[model samples]
Target: MTTRDPAARLLRLLSLLQSRTDWPGPELAGRLGVSTRTIRSDIERLRNLGYPVAATPGTAGGHRLGSGARLPPLLLDDEEAVAVAIGLRTAAAQAVGGIEETSLRALTKLEQVLPARLRPRVAALAASTVPLPGNGPAVDGDVLTALAVACRDRRRVRFDYHDHKGNATLRDVEPHRLVSTGQRWYLVAWDIDRNDWRMFRIDRLRPRTPMGPSFPGRSLPPGEAIDFVTKGVASTLEPCRTVATVHAPVTAVSERVPPVARVEHLDDQRCLLHIGAAAPLTLAVYLAALGLPFTVDGPPALLEALRRMSQHCAGAVSPATPAMSASQPRADAW
Candidate 1:
């Protein structure tokens, strides 16, 4: 039999090791078309490179890759490779701090090496999808990772946080889960000082790691993590509220409005929309585009903006003269 290159043999051995929980020595040798001795040598080579390949003692024992302090290169199957590449492409479009550029760079590298058959699949999916850019603040990738690690390891973490008012304060918390809402990332944690659960914006967090001691995990709040974060965000809205009664059913209008807005049914045919925006004019424009006739019940500013917009729209449609001579061309004439 022709001798295989040591590098190629080692990579094959590593791939086999990564694909399953364990492989007996003879089975690995048979699969690699090598002797048991070569399998041992290749396993040693992997360990020397910092991949913790562990061997068991009995006849049924084989080798398995064990966890290490640092992440090793992933060996993904075809489906896994496509999934990861697609995920990286999606992450590149989000506002996750410094990682946006990093994700794109990694995706480029991965796509360059994808098998010929898989490359076009990934490219096709990417070409068909369009991701709207998020308007939320960017978060630090390292801080995001640290918090995630703390959550998984059940360790408490300390960080300096700034509130909506930009008031800086120190926080010590037991990290639980990290939630992403496309526009923003949030961390739901148990605040040690306050003795309550709090949802924090990832952008507003500055985690100081060499994290605190581990704590016993507890059940999350009554709702899902996303729900907790949503409620937390809703509580911080500005005072500029816009309430409008729309001539549409609650279900129909609710589907058109953003999840942050409130839709209360006035009856079977009408619903009240409670929305908040920094600018009354912005709210007015959004309401106008809802395609349903609505009456503004407001803080006066939204009403004024809507009224002004209405006048402009009315003037735009009304002709300069009520009567036109037959010789004059009609407005709707081609």
Candidate 2:
């Protein structure tokens, strides 16, 4: 970690400072193979180049990189450069309202400066990757930024929200975390008036300026934020709910179901799937589409729906076609 070239030494020093919040002066000197006086000089040089290098003077004094008025050039290694480039490329295809263009601009700049050896790897990835078209509405970037800031500061927010039925109402809430379900964005927060935790659709809410007063953070309801939002959304949209014993590994079942459906591991050969839909028939159809063997442990209605579906499917088959035995494990039957 020692360098004789002054410019290279300064760049190495900057990288070290950025890697951690604080470093003892002696440790910095030792790492750079320089005296403490030389480390002090290097710190000054970094500051002159627009890097806010803060120093504390004393026996145990250290140096730290602080926030500056403007961003300075970052020194990223080969791996970091590739990672950033790929991340930006992926983000460029997302449905986040105004971020696609910005992400593309950043990706372009990053690729232009990437080391020659790394350029091919990044270019090949960009050439091979394809993102699915997002079906969700675009979320306002300004609103997203404001909500993030409020959540970080634990501040109350006032916004006008529209319900599923298109009813508009004013809401004051203590901002929590924002969750993205790939198709849509949701805000998980505590409602001031309702005195309960609620999940709001980000695209349907307009944040009011001059947010409400700062509030003490509250412990989120059981499970992670994503779990809470998904469950809430499912309950609201689908009234019929049931659990099924799916005869498949958890990973396989997880890959087949949507995020709104919760899958619990039972054993190596089976898992429990908790899901809901507007009607028992709809749920039955969804399960059948999985093309996997499963048995429903549900309300009588769901079982009845599956019974009717089986009969209809059997009738549709030609009489000459061999019938499946009752005990046979059909890969496409549930």
Clashes of each: 0, 0
The candidate scoring highest on lDDT is: 2
TM-score, every prediction: 0.68, 0.88
Candidate 2 ranges with C-alpha deviation above 4 Å: 221-223, 278-281, 297-305, 308-334
Candidate 1 per-residue C-alpha lDDT over 230-295 given as tens digits, one digit per residue, 9 for 90 to 100: 656655764567678899899888878765677889999999987766677877877887878888
lDDT of each: 0.83, 0.90
lDDT of 2 by residue, 170-277 (tens): 999998999988888999999999999889999999999998789988998536788999898899888999989999999888988888999999999999999999
Q: Estimate the lDDT of model 2.
A: 0.90
Candidate 2 local lDDT, residue 54: 87
In angstroms, the error of model 2 at 57 is 2.0
The regions of model 1 sitting more than 4 angstroms off are: 1-9, 24-42, 48-50, 67-73, 221-223, 238-334
Candidate 2 to truth, TM:
0.88
